[model samples]
Target chain A: MAIKQRKLELGVLVASLALVTSCKREDRPFQTSAPSAEAIQFTRMTDFRAGGPSISGNQPSPAMSADETPEEKEFEENAYMVGEGKRLFSAFNCVGCHAHGGGGMGPALIDDQWIYGHEPAQIFCTIIEGRPNGMPSFGGKIPSFQVWQLASYVRSLGGLVPGDAAPGRDDDMHGGPPENSAPNQKPNDSSLPKSAEMPK
Target chain B: MIAAATARWATLADNDFGVTSGEWVRGTKSVLDPAGPQSGRIHQLFLDYFWLSVVVYVLVVLFVIFAVILRRRRARWTGPILAEPAPSREKLRGWLVGLATLATTIALFFLLAGDHAAGRAIRSLSTDNALKIRVTGHQWWWEFRFEDEAPSKIFTTANEIHIPVGRTIEVELHSPDVIHSFWVPNLHGKRDMIPGHPTRIAFRADKASEYWGQCAEFCGYEHAKMRFRVVAEPEEKFNAWKAAQLQSSVQPATDSQKKGQYVFLHTTCVMCHTIQGTTAGAMMGPDLTHLASRKTIAAGSLPNKRGHLAGWISNPQTIKPGVRMPANSLPPDQLQALLDYLEILK
Candidate 1:
């Protein structure tokens, strides 16, 4: 009777141990480190409505400081690289269908005839969002930097000096300057007369 | 029994048992002999294989029957069933060996012969002597363009391909949209027209006659409508036809024809067609710059008669569903004028 009692006690102890082991195996530990502020901001921005302004109401606008040196201004002005854009343009075989400057299967990029508008931002959008007939969208195919380079190449078509052109002038043919300008600031106005702006 | 008899009678009527009439029949004096180099090679190959098959079949059947009867009679005298070693094992092995040797020889011969014939077909002709013609395949039509001419001098004709008899003609085939096959059965076998790739077929017709062919590939909704005609004429006649095609489209002589041209330009016709001299420069469809010159319409499915032409213009989709050419609901007077203008496309 004492041996029987000891055997029952041993079985119960084994069962309790097995149960505790399985419970511990199934449990998952919570993450300790917090996500970066930039990542959290990006997720919030993407959740906004379609065609909404990229910036939120709370964030302050980017500004140029008085402490900015001549070297910095020159670098900012020279930010649009014409040489890199030209290399990317030729490598992508954009000329094969466009035919040097004359249109064949695709429209002429050099001419004033803008199907989606010749502004830099608009051109960028057009490149990212392709036209229906034949042009395929390169949004995901190319990197963001490469797209900006292509936009610069197209902007050069209008006789604009490559490095001198500002980054985000909305009305200027590079897709009406960049969208992230200061709250009240308007983009650079086009010098061409209203009559001359019309495409032939 | 009645139904079977009626079916037999219909079959008999369709069969060309004996060549009673002057019209051509299979296994009779050929309308066009397969005399060209490529066709001659193919014909000889076919005959050799056919005779070989007949001889082998007869010998095998006779041998099998003779062996079976002899073996059964010999075994009959022995007890009800004598367990003997397989007697025909050696014979079966010998037969198999003989058959394999025969098959290998025939296969090797065909492989070598086919390679040689294909090589000879594609071998380039002397530049000075060879005639070069560009054949473009559309949805349900063919556009023939003769080389050695300017863009303006380029004449667009459909359905029919004109060639000079006994002269080697090299045709470069191109397809604008989907795949299409060019075939002229009596003249030459079919060659496919693949997009972005030009395929060439070289052959000479031994006889001067019109041979019929249809697009062998099911290109689209109008695959059946995509028929072609090979009009093999004498050298002098071919030259004259070429010269006539190069000439400008004749202007409308009658007031009704003038009205038709106006209707063609103003109506939906201008949206899909092109006429070289007029404002109709749209290229969504075939160039009707020289439409009347073609012997048949709707590819080669319909004769180029006024009635068929009118019917096609009224409701093309009814005849060939899914056809790119839509039905033009025109007033009677406008439709008549358009028909008149289209008839003179030559």
Candidate 2:
């Protein structure tokens, strides 16, 4: 009987040690450095399609988009970064066009449909480099680190970020449900279907 | 040690209160110094109430003392006495008590009548075309909107209120958040500004002077610092001020000013504040069209100096904690340019 009790005690100690070792380690918000361009990767329509439309205007044409970098990992996991990004979203006048992701002048960010790729790398590129019609380029204006933070926040709006890291409600008017309570949406790349018509 | 401390306190008190002259000390915002008819009526009512209470107290105390003296003189011995009370004496005491109660009731009735008369005078203005100004009370700030029939003529300003002297100024009070009370002791009594329930208060300033007004209600953080100044000026001066406020922001003349304007439009400043004739039109914050023209900034918490403005722009949290305006991380050159641009806003 004494031997059985000793075995049970040893089992409980080993189990607790495993649980502690598996606990998540969080990086402080706004403390990380910007990731290198080589770290970012994503899928473009041109890469998948046999023949696709060429990139138009002064818009940037990167190879592809959305393979999570270590810097992005830090942003999506930190709750403070998400909250700070929500504040910056208003301060940078993102709500002026997006209107809390419901889409006024710009397209809705909360919806599943992504004109560009729905990956974090793709979102970061779209903000840093201006799109065709209305989306202004904030490359030289906002710091690169802040742009990454904003991308993480945008992902949260679509219920893409982790639930624990998402922001809560604002002190102002109750516009809609908060980002944390947002339902998960599977990203659908709409650009792939219309990629066959190539521009000379 | 205690005696020494008391002696020092007595000397300090003597220095503060001891006077050779018979002149009364009147504060700049004292209710005793009536600048309008509304305050004058209130002052008179307060005086009447004060003197009436004093008279009643004195009479009661004297009557009690007189009764004690009479009873002592009429007593035969100091020990317990066996004496029958007279029916006439009891009847007289009943009559006296009834008379005192009647006098008190009459005094209260008179005060009620005075209060009603003051209320009527405060509500009813002599002229039909009183200047209408809508005051919206925020957490710790005041927004004043001067209404007009024409949209072009309508303008909004904050903190400092200017009105033409000798004219009834009608103010409609509103609150988007918690309850606040607006009180200009020199001009009018405090009136509650309840959220969702609009209230109105009318008063006319007879004197051409500046009077300070403060938030009478206990609001959230920095409530004590929530203050404004009422400038009662001549009709011509008031109109000129109004005309200047109606105009849009001026175009930048210097290179630094242009850079400053660019900084303001491009940064978080544009996200909240509005500068007329500029693309930075957002109503979430105050309208900075005529900001430089105003005497103070941050809802009259700080003087409108370049140093103060710089400190406020860099870190407003340190100066006024929990304010909605975030700290802008602008370089020295950009901050200087911003100040130059703002100064020309007048």
The best candidate in terms of TM-score: 2
Candidate 1 structure lDDT: 0.61
Quality of candidate 2 docking, DockQ: 0.12
Question: What is the C-alpha local distance difference test score of each model?
Answer: 0.61, 0.77
Interface RMSD for each candidate model? Answer: 21.0, 5.3
lDDT of 1 by residue, A1-200 (tens): 99999999999999999887645322221211111212222222123322343344533323222222222222122333433355456555665676544567987554455665554445555665465677755543444444555665655544443333423332113322232221222223343544677787
Model 1: per-residue Cα lDDT over B211-321, one tens digit each: 666677989777877776777789999988888777766688899999999888765677567787788776656677778877667776566678778888887766666
After superposing candidate 1 on the true structure, give the runs of residues whose Cα lies further than 4 Å from its correct spot. A1-200, B1-35, B77-128, B149-154
Residue B109 Cα positional deviation in candidate 1, in Å, after optimal superposition: 4.0
Best by DockQ: 2
